[model samples]
Target chain A: MTDGLWVYLAASPLLWLAGTLVVWIAASSVAKFRPGNPFLNPIMLTIAAIAGILCATGIDYGTYFEGAQFIHFLLGPATVALGIPLYEKLSLVKSNLVPMLSALVVGCLAAVGSTVFLSELFGFAPAIVASLAPKSTTAAVAMAISSGLKGDPALTAAVVVFTGICGAVVVTPMMNAMRIKDFSARRTCVPWDWHRACLLRGSRRRIVFRNSYGTECNSNISCCTSVSVSQLDSEHLHVDAERRQAHKRDQGAGCRLSQWKSEPGKHRARTRLDAINGQQPRRRPYRRGPVD
Target chain B: MLNGLAILFTFQLAGEIVAYLLGGWVPGPVVGMAMIAVALTLTRSTSFLNPAHEGTVSTSKTILANLGILFVPAGVGIIQHLDLIRDRGFALLAVVVLSTVATLTLTVWTFILVKRLSGGYGND
Candidate 1:
């Protein structure tokens, strides 16, 4: 009777789908209390738990994917959804266009060139090296690029996730150790890089930034502003502290442009920062008139 | 929500067509992203009054907030490459780590250099 039940459940499409969701929820719940703990990453946990269960139960990845593909299909839509945040950051992007584009050119070349060069130095096969080439971008885009290059999309996706995790773990210490003082300089790559999500979550726990370059935006975190500074010098930290206080005062309405105007305290912070710079705050894309 | 989803899907479909016409040089979703971004920028003046715009932004936020989960299915594809992973896991890890470091350092350095040359502090 139990054996029959096992076979029946395994055959149902809902089984692994439900299983993946449950495992993910549990992993997220466990990781919730310890903010910034990369080791307890819910995605990593869910993938590991499900992969382990499948292995022990003798279910092949193909079988498991049949049910899980429903979730996977959302990646395409999520990619489209990235436009909203990209739109939101248009003003900032405009102001930083030169720096942004220059960084993109240098970053893309460094990301792909370094990966390919190092992979070859490590004696990886051409296909495998190609798979690793686009690991710095979003998993979906990287997978597509990998396929175009005649590499394995699966390998590319896996490497992308791995590279993201590694980037997340290393970025904070590496940046801090180098004493990167400018908040904007540190996140210049955020608009073009998804690897910073881990850095975002690990370091800036308050506001989640949604800016990216040419890939689907990761939305596992908050989506208000990507400009949250992490461990910056005292001056920027003071501005951030004021912003945080303003956010709290507004009952967590966040730093949305709409909210930024209504919250006098946030407005005051921005005005003060602008005064210090001896210039006016850059015009917001959504603002209707001159500063009040 | 449904209206917003429709808009997103429409853009994605358009993106697919664009990508196909371009011989897949760019991914469909990315092309779709650029299209929506352009649309949003074009409509920014009236975005405050457009309910559909609000709906799209909120809908996209909700989806992106759970983006990590969407990656699971593909990340699990590592199962298929277990042999390669097993054979060169350390080498692969080293390469990823080193390359990532190199990329981040170079990108940040370049941005700072350019920003300074442009006479801005990157304060914003």
Candidate 2:
């Protein structure tokens, strides 16, 4: 009777949803304690924990996925929802159109070219090479591209996740060490969501300030700005703190533009920082006015 | 929430139609994303699909917040390829890591160089 019950429970779709949510919540809670360690990446932890459970229970992946498809279906709408952020940042994107387009083309080509060349050099099968070709793109898009090229969608999905984690772990520290602080370049190269999640979750300080050259300094960590970039001095740091506080206070009110108007220098710095970070400073509703 | 979803699906459906007509050279969702992005740009001055609207923003955030969950099913699919991975795990790891770093570095540097050559930071 118990074995029969176990089989029925394992086959239910609710089992997968409940298991995934419980594991993810537990992993995220654990991650909070470490605060800034990439190894504790919540997604990685949750995947391991659940995979271990599935293996131990001898439940096949197909059964689990059958239940999990409910969550998976949301990915389509979520992907389409990416337009929200892209829409929010339309003006910034429009202003930098030329450079942004060029960077995107170059980045896409480099991602595919390097993966293919290295996979070939390493003697990976052609299918594996094809899967790796679109590894840097979002998983849904990568899977489609991989299928079109005759690669395994499952392998492509796995590689895409691996690539994201690798980029999250390696790139930030490498860029910091090299002192490559150009905001435009960073914005152009790094996918927006990946960069935000990695930087925000990994650092205790919530707000990051970019100096003119693009080096990011944690502004709120010490109740004062910690200026790590060589070009910025204490004076700029002081101004950055004031501006950040003002911006935060007004953030809820959606009056970022008004605050910006109050201090042109602060506004310029804030805009520059937002651009560099690939974030948009929150703004109030659009109003038809001569001053807007 | 429903309205936001409606807008999303509508655009996705339109993209599918276009892609189908064009023989699927590009993926439908991607084309849909571009179409939505273009629509947003055109409608920025109006409130038609203002992303800042409370309902839309909150709904979009909820969907994106759990974005990792969407990839879980696919990641679990890795179980099927365990044999291939076991045989070439080390080489696969090395290539993925090296190629990712190389691509990121090259992309960032190339963008910076191009931006500088184009007279820096454009009009913004």
Candidate 3:
């Protein structure tokens, strides 16, 4: 054979992913022994390990993405799952929806505008400037913008990662220094830009996820067409009103929605779970706490 | 832990279907998230108050526990692009900082203004 099967089976991306998994196991193992090691983070360790493997094997980037993309697919489901916590925090979102939305819009505009402006000022290339425009958003969305803006997707990914890491490292301290005790800065960004769960988790763990932008409040990452959960009781019908409205609306769906005290327009979800699978509706409760 | 993770997964898959039917203009993940929020909103408890199942990690917890893992790929991207950053590092740094600050400012402003105009999420 031409070793095609071996090459295909030995795809570089597989090595990268396998490397990633191995690094995680190793770091976690180290953590078990020495929980306080600073340089032992799986993040740093994994990257180094993979880079070393790719170097030793002479695997190019294109080959690595093939298998690595398998893990990338999880991004869709992971992002979607972030809403559960956001919904649980719907009240908090509602209590501060205006501030949140204001922050998101202004933040988006400012982030994009300033980068474009300053990059041009600094005499960066148009492609570089364009790529930088959407760096404030998450990676997937930013990648889309990069392609559209003719900027380097890889470069944009770099900016986004740096942005996230810096935000995580700095925001809390900055807030503390500024005495901005409002603590939660609700940013009504687009849906699908679901990065709020981390901040929520940080808040719950009292670890403070820094520089958080609650863009998911606006729509599906910022794509929320329905009202937030906290606003349900007040903006939603009172029990009697909801009960009556349910009767007036669908009579059936409304009744079901009302059973759980939900607002109609927002939660119009159709869970196409396999009815024939004999699987019961999930009843497990989360211990890590919902929505952080 | 695993059980909770499974619930979270179920929530996501189911939420995807629900969001699509609603004509979501955004990506599927956001819809799934909103769907999860809706489900939790309807339920009597949360991941915090009620433990999903012992020895079975909930989806909610799994995401959090694996949070750092999720970000590792991005970090790796950082390593790959170190050369680019070093070359035009100043401009890139400005972009990252300014964009982040700007987004944060706009988001907060809009949220507060909307709250004022909409009578605080238009509730009561």
Candidate 4:
């Protein structure tokens, strides 16, 4: 019975899935406990925990990967799924296309160029430089780019993961200290999802700093959402003003409608009320305080 | 959920075909993403293209939420290159950290300067 159980556990994908999920959940739980503490990042913690487990169990990476590949397959679909958010905020993206695109291009070049230059300065191999070239892009793209440049895909993957974790860990505090509050610039430079993932609240203007190893899709989505929200807010204000003016113009037409118009002032008041009542309740549990 | 997945996969497949026909210079998934975005713009009237739809949004969120997990297997493969890491670890670490911070600062400052030059805001 014991021998049979060991074989089943080793052969089945369940062990890997269960292990990954448990480590992730536990890491996230610890992250929640510490709140803004970057050292407790779920990704870093999960990686460390799993690496420890594999090392302890003496399981070769090949066997471990056979089961892990099941989870890895979802990455492709996830990359495609990024289209949802991108589509939703397409208009905002279109409006700021020039600035956003220029910034992205410059940022991408800086990230890749600096890595290659520094690697060469340190006398590293060309393969290592190639692997590092796409370190700031998403894992899938980075791997593909690495392969194209004749770099080791596995090395690129490791470097990409490390860059992401470092970005998540170090960037937030640095941003806070630097007092970088320009939302447009911030949106263009940093991945907003990192802020969302960090669970920080208030100011809504947190710095994201995605220049190191942020994925293109994520940075695009962040830029779109930031521009959209601000644009939508302005549009909403303009519409409200127009409605108020229309109400004043139509006051002579009908008494009943005028009675409705009497409450035009209340429209802004009600929306503010609705915004506070509707939006805050949903987000309050997730956000512990104004800063953290 | 199923529909969202199918749509994404279909675009990705089309991208793969295009990339292959074009000598595979560009990555298939990136091309697929661009195609999907273009399709979404061209077919904005279609209800299925609505990103806010519950199924589409939820499916996207669920998949992206755990993106880090998908990279684990590849990261673990680093064990095979322990020698490379050991030989060049310090340089690699310094470059990644310093260059990342430098890139972030440069990008952010450049964006602000560009935005200012375009007269988007009055006061810096």
Model 3: per-residue lDDT, tens digit, B1-124? 5555565566557766765786643445555556655655566553543322332224543554454455445445544666776897876776666655555545545555665576653565
Q: What is chain B's TM-score across the candidates, in the order shown?
A: 0.88, 0.83, 0.60, 0.84
Query: What DockQ values do the models have?
Result: 0.53, 0.46, 0.27, 0.44
The most accurate candidate by DockQ is 1
Better of 1 and 3 by DockQ: 1
Q: Kindly list the per-residue Cα lDDT of model 1 for residues B84-122, writing each as its tens digit.
A: 988999999999999888988987888788988987774
Ranking by lDDT: 1, 2, 4, 3
Report lDDT per candidate.
0.67, 0.62, 0.49, 0.61
Candidate 2 - CAPRI tier?
acceptable
Native-to-model Cα distance after best TM-score fit, residue A8 in candidate 2, in Å: 1.4
DockQ-based ranking, best first? 1, 2, 4, 3
Report the Cα interface RMSD of each model, rounded to 1 decimal. Answer: 3.9, 7.2, 4.4, 3.9
Tens-place lDDT per residue, model 4, A123-197, is: 988887888887776676677678888998778877776776566666656655667655555545554324334
Question: What is the TM-score (0 to 1) of candidate 4?
Answer: 0.75
Candidate 3's displacement at residue B22, Å, is: 10
lDDT of 4: 0.61
| Pairs in clash, predicted candidate 4 | A136-A213
lDDT of 1 at A189: 47
Question: What TM-score does model 1 achieve against the real structure?
Answer: 0.78
